[model samples]
Target: MRRNILPGLLIVLVAVIGNRLSPNFLDFAYLRDSATLVAELGLIAVGMNFIITSGNIDLSVGSNMVLTACITAKFMVGGMPAPLALLLGVGIGTLLGWLNGVLITYFRAPSFLITVATMAMYRGAAKALLGPQSVKAPSGIVGIDTQTFAGLTIPLLILLVTASIGAFVMQKTIFGSWVVAVGSNSRTALYSGVPVARVVRTSYTLTGFICGIAAMLMLSRLGLARHDLAMGSELDIITIVVVGGTAIQGGAANVIGSLLAFILIALLRSVMGVANFTAEYQMTIIGILLIGMVLANRLPLKLILQKLRPKSQRAP
Candidate 1:
């Protein structure tokens, strides 16, 4: 609990100070918009958390999002029902994810190299599928943007539900335990009879499913889908996952921590927007934050704090 509590407090502190530093950020609209942005990114970050915790990474998430969106646009343009289009998008994403899993598991390839290659392949395929033009979703499907319940945007609600389910799966279930075990030491887990390959494959498949969901939300927000949708977004997703305290080397991950990190990054973006900072500055800040968080995770700060406390007050 301390692990979760500390990072959460730090995130809140950053948000409060950031708002104070930028007067334009104190408004309700800014906060709502920021929340929506975080939710969108959080959807994928949660899935990435699972993949990373399983001792793997998926660089094709951004491309998956684009491909899903392109497929969704094509369906919608063909006058298909919204529900059908949505399902097709998710199906396409799941297949892509399964392909990744099969390639990595069967060929004994590094996940990093495999996903990097798929990332390019998926993006190129999306561009070819959608051609050089963009497709706009019908006004009815786009109307989801204006729909809300309980003071939350529909998209935000979807994000909340996805995060909640992800947190449950990663923290409370047998599968979650298996994920940590496999990630911490695959050979040991295998000796203990855990299905390492199955876990790893499922992680990638789930990641693709999440990417599909994110594509729908993005399509709603933009009211249009293009081959370039979510381009280079994999970097942002990876940054949030690391910033949230997920170990880059695999072993342990914090779902709530990743959620807080998602919020922090979104707040940073909102602040940048209000301050009119260049995109370069935003990227630089994210890069610095990622490096700092990774370094901090490697430190024995807790042990140092224990040492600094008064001997009389310390636990025996």
Candidate 2:
């Protein structure tokens, strides 16, 4: 409960600020549409929470989304059925994640290094495939994001459902326990019969799986697929995870907090947009937020405050 306060407060603050900036900002339709805009990032961030909780990271997710979307776009342009293309993209995404897992487990390498390399490889592959041109998204897949059910856009609905399921899995299941145990202390978990390698691998693969889904929605939303899609989005996703109060060094996961953080992020962006901030400014803000959260996690605030106090005022 305490962990969620910051993000929740930020949401309210952003909402208030946005309403002041743009009188229509609090409109239901506008908020709903804005939620759709963030669905892709939210999906990837949900998976990222799991990976971070398992004491691992994947810098390749943004690239994975682009590459998967590019592949699907290629198939669609080649006259393949939209459903088939979408399914293939998701399968490839899962396979890409599994590959990351295998390489990490086999080499006993840090995921950060492996994923950085894979991130470049994935982005390079997308660039090679498309080469400064975007493939046209197929008819069926193109408007999926615009479609509404129960007064909510399909993308937002997908996000809500996915987040709910992710929350349940992380909070209720034995697999969740395994992930937490491995993250908190791998050696101890291994001694206790936990499959540490499998947990790490699964977490990466799950991120890739979610990336695949995000890719499809992205393609639908943008009406095209290109190598440069979602460039540097990993920063925002990581910010959302970290701001949600997930420990950077692992051992904790906060699904609900992340959800609120996503809303806060969306609202902040909307506020910035209302105030006419450029994309560069938005990126700068996200960068600052990411750095601040990381430092906050590492810094001992209470101890620092204790040292700052005068000797006479300090506790014994």
Candidate 3:
């Protein structure tokens, strides 16, 4: 419990620092509006958490989002009904994810290398679909993120529901056990008949399916599709998962913590925005945070504990 609470405390500390940078950081409207816009990235972060917890990474998610959105846009432009067009986008995203799983498992390829290649492939395909220009989505289509219900915006509600189900699956099910076991030790999991391949495949596919949904939400919210949509988002998504206290080497995840991390990062970026920082500088700051989190794990626990202990208790 103390371990999980560490991240929560860090969130409070970051918020305090943000408020120091900009008084508007504490504004209710700023926070609420930020929460609504963050659901897109937050959704990807949730799925990436699942994949990372299962001992793999999907670098192609940004590309996956763009490709799905492009497909939906093409479908809509072709006179298809909006609902079916959106569903196809999700289905294609799942297939793309399944492709990643298949190649990694069957070919015994390095996950990092395979995903990197497909990341380009997927993004290129999206550009190919539109020939290097953005496509406007059907104007009559109402966005799920546009309205709030009972004091909660629809996109936020969707994210909460998604996270709740994900939390249950990750924390309460046999499959969750398999995922942790596989991540912690693949060979042992395979030897124990846990079907490591299936677990991994399921994780990647779930990521793709969620990205598909994210594509739908983004498409509706922006009313357009472009090959560049969500470009470079994979890094941001990974940053959220790692800073939330999930082990990069696998075996653990904190869903609620990731949500808080998303909010923390969002607030931090917004703070920088208010201070007139350029996007490049802001991303550099976040990149530093990501690296720090990864390196923090290398420190010995005794040293960390000693640093946390009172100086009076230290040896002379």
Candidate 4:
């Protein structure tokens, strides 16, 4: 609960500042529309929360998203049915994620290194497949963002449903418990009969599944897929996870916190755009914020306070 306060406050602060910058900032319809834009990122962040909570990371998520999007778009443009293309994309994403898990568990190497290598490989594969070109998603599959049910966009609804399910899985189920245990201490968990390898692999695979969904949404909204799509998005995704108060090291899962953090991120970007901040400036600010949150999470509160105190008042 304490971890949620900063993001909640930041959301309010951004909204107030946004209202000052643009009349539409506080407009419900405008904000609702803006929510659609970040829905893809939100989806990925939810899965990322699972990955981090399981004590693993997937730097290849952005690449996975792009690769899935590209493949789906290519097939759709090549006259395949939209439904088939979407399923194919999800399957490919799942396979890619499973591959990452296999390599990590089999080689017993750090997930960070494994994912970093796969990240490059996946991106390269996408680039090779779609060299210097973009493919238009089929009209049948496009416009999902514009579709509404009960006055909410499909993307937003999807995010809400996914987050809700994720929250339940993380907090209530046996699988959730296993993930937490594995992340907290793999050796201990294994000794206690927990399937550590399977837990970690499942987490990564789940993240890939979510990434696939994100790719579909992105393709639907943008109507185009390129190798470079979602480039550098992993940064924002990780930032959302970290800011949501999920432990970066492992053993924690905060799905609701992640959902709220994503909203804060979306609002911050909206406010910055309304204020006419350049993309470069927006990224720089977000990067700094990510770093700050990481430090705040890693440092001990007493140590932080001690440093803030004057030398004359320092503890002996």
Regions of candidate 3 where Cα sits further than 4 Å from its true position: 306-316
Instruction: Tell me which of candidates 1 and 3 scores higher on lDDT.
Output: 3
lDDT of 1 by residue, 1-316 (tens): 5555645776677677777877666676667766776465788999999889888999999898888898888889998998889888888888888889889988978999999999999999989897889999888767565577898778777877887888899889989989999889989999999988888888888888888888888888888888876766777788888878788888897887777777777777787777788877887877787777778878998788889999997767
Expressed as tens digits, the lDDT of each residue in 245-316 for candidate 3 is 778988888777787787777777777777788978877888888898788756686777788889999756
TM-score of each: 0.93, 0.93, 0.93, 0.94
Model 2, which residues run further than 4 Å from truth? 298-316
Candidates sorted by TM-score, descending order?
4, 2, 3, 1
Which candidate leads the pack in lDDT? 4
Q: Relative to the unseen true structure, what is the C-alpha lDDT of residue 108 in candidate 3, on a scale of 0 to 100?
A: 74
Ranking by lDDT: 4, 2, 3, 1
lDDT winner, 2 or 3: 2
lDDT of 2 by residue, 11-118 (tens): 888899898888889998888887788789988999999999999888999999999999988988999988888899898888888888889988999999999999
Candidate 4 vs. true structure, TM-score: 0.94
Q: lDDT of all predictions, in order shown?
A: 0.83, 0.88, 0.84, 0.90
Clashes per prediction?
A: 0, 0, 0, 0
Off by over 4 Å in 4: 302-316
Q: How accurate is candidate 3 locally (lDDT)?
A: 0.84
lDDT of 2 at 52: 92
Candidate 4 clash pair list? none
Question: In candidate 4, how many Å is residue 118 off?
Answer: 1.1
